[model samples]
Target: MDQDDSETCQMCPMDEWPNREKTRCLPKLQEFLSYKEDKMASFFCFLVILCCVITCFTLKKFILYWDTPLVKANNRTLSFTVLVSLLLSFLCVFFFLGRPLDITCMLRQTLFGIFFSLAISSLIAKSMMVCIAFKATKPSSSWKKWTGVTLPYSIVVVCSSVQVLICVSWLSTYPPYQGFDMTTYPGKIIIQCNEGSDIWFYSMLGYLGFLAAVSFVLAFMVRTLPDSYNEAKYITFSMLVFCSVWIAMIPAYLSTRGKYMVAVEIFAILTSCAGILSCIFLPKLYILLIKPYLNTRKHVFSWVRK
Candidate 1:
């Protein structure tokens, strides 16, 4: 045999076998690529959710801070932090839009990140609020009127800023055209942030999961309180909706494949809609505008919107 043939036989490891490598690595790469594509797609739905989450929590906090008995008399540290963090969260979405990457992708990640921050902030604030509310009526009496929003958004903001910065630096370090793309399928190349492993994505899932869990536990506690406490019920119900929405995301995340994961994001928009409609606004409207119906009850056919 020739010297070249000998070298080829000796150097070829099992993984480097020509056709065999194609069989194993190619399929695995395709699955991963599909996953990446789905991640990108899901980003769209995530943006709408981010808007909803931020708008609901931040605006209501502003209103609540102005006059709610929940934060009766404590330091405004949490309140101010949540407020400022929310503002920054919204700004993050806006500035993220101007990134050179595909606007659609930027929109998705920005929205997702903001939504995440708000979710965390809401959980922290709600848990504290619930605890304070319960404790206020008890022995210590120190928590009277001390309702503070849990400014978890601050940590989320810093973490998200770093994540975005990492992604931006990775993308800008080289022009898109010159980037190394893994060709996973025929005529298809995987475009990923590649800051590291998919840890960022999983971190999101983990954080969101933690927030949802806190919301669920506190909501359970709130519901068990006296029915005379109607305000508690409303907040609890809203939290229930938020928690459920985040919980439902687990399956979508698992089943998603690249570019298709956007469907999961779209789902977020619908959930956010439900959260706003059923949780916060509907209850308040019922209390404010429709409560009069309780005294002079009347019925009418609903009018259809054109």
Candidate 2:
């Protein structure tokens, strides 16, 4: 065809582009979650960073009071592990904030699922540890031998390994990639990550929820155990918050499209993780930093009697 008979394409305005006919323009694909283009992404990035800083402060406190009876009573190793996982989970939000590149799309859900699994698994292990501690206090109880860090560490490892395997299978079977949905909205393109398989995504979430539910039930049953330093009560509340946020998130996430959907998942991640961090650890931090006397063995025993 002659040059005049052929078509030419030129760059359109921001968030718009020429249609196939090239005579008119339509809304462009909203591809990126950049700070300049979307303030919501920027806001979430700030939140993630803030939460990370808080996690650091919490870790510092835990290390400083590592020798205290209150800190010792709660398995310190498990505590540190849980804190680190929570921090990683918060940092994972950064993946959701940026553009949905090939690598980010592939790793975001996998890492998020793994980190959350680790956190929930740690909570479950801690709850089991609390139960073991109380049972072992009984004279001649066989649970005494299992009341060490070994069980909790094993629980974290086994639970996390399962998630790792699931993610590996998901990536191996149908890995996610940068996708564009051109028909979702009229005359507009929605750029997002195609999460490959719904089964794998929901399966990961289901498994994490199962761990949380078990943790909640165990912690609730043991919350009344006679120890002022007990963590069962805190675990119960944290699991409640964690389960509630994700449960509500599923429908909201499915109802939205494009960037809003991403926003919903990010919101769920931040809120659920923050719930675990604040509920499980803040009370201990209060005692460790603000009221050191309450962290002593004498105070624990005294409160147990009252």
Candidate 3:
């Protein structure tokens, strides 16, 4: 075709242009409407509160039984074990969510990866703490004193830091998640930190799997410990619940049907709530409230003392 025809093609009538921007400039990245942001923020905020309530109640019970002869008599090393979940819940509430879209995928992924790493590492550290407690009871020897403040925490810091660097590097090198020249939703171009590449997506899966692995080991170690069968059963059940997340999360991330995907995310968060409550909160409640009799010395393991 001649140059005039080509130029005319570009000047095709306004109605003929697919979108106004196709005639002129690059399409703008979509921003979530402030209302949409607020709505999502509010919903997640409520979820945070719900998690906090469950965590705080459990911690309260742990505090109550912490100094009792029953808790100490078990030779538990620390004055508090359940307190960490309470603290993590508070951290999650205060720090996570309502994040700005990072233009630099490097910074964005770094921040996300760091938080993800810390959260999982904290959970794994918890499992290690449980195992150490079990090990302390062995008749053999000096491993008891080995269980203390610094070592497990240090391990967590190291693992989390390593993975944070891994994720940051991946993001720095990839094209930002919006992708190269793809048509996006015009009115609703929401700024989400996408998984930079297949590597990041699968890495997240691997990371969750790793956390589940450690959790399972702890669950196994505690499986046969000489505690009330109910306590043992609850912990095992909770661990199983937690592990199921890794299995479920793959499909959640892969889902691309917009709001359907959001529903999946919501379900995932709800799963977290259930796991935390079942594993950390409700068990403490059973000891402190529902079965307060269990806390009493010389009490028979019966439904009623009648």
**Candidate 2: tens digits of C-alpha lDDT, residues 1-306:** 112345754556545666666666676656557777898988998899999999999999999989888888778888998999999999999888767888999999999999989988888898898888778877999999998767888999998899999999999998889987766775566778998998998888888888889989989988997667688898899989988898899899989998899999999999999999999899998888798888888866554455
Largest TM-score belongs to which candidate? 2
| Model 1 regions more than 4 Å off | 1-107, 138-196, 228-248, 269-273, 292-306
How many steric clashes does model 2 contain?
Answer: 0
- Which tens-of-lDDT digit does each residue in 229-299 have in candidate 1? 32345546655665677668768866854333434544554564356344533443344345534312121
Q: What global local distance difference test value does model 3 have?
A: 0.52
Q: Residue 250 error for model 1, in Å?
A: 3.5
Model 2 poorest ten-residue lDDT run: 1-10
Model 2 TM-score, 2 decimals: 0.90
lDDT of 2 at 85: 95
Q: State model 2's lDDT.
A: 0.86
Q: Order candidates by TM-score, high to low.
A: 2, 3, 1
Against the true structure, candidate 3 reaches a TM-score of 0.63
- Residue-level error in angstroms, candidate 1, position 128: 2.7
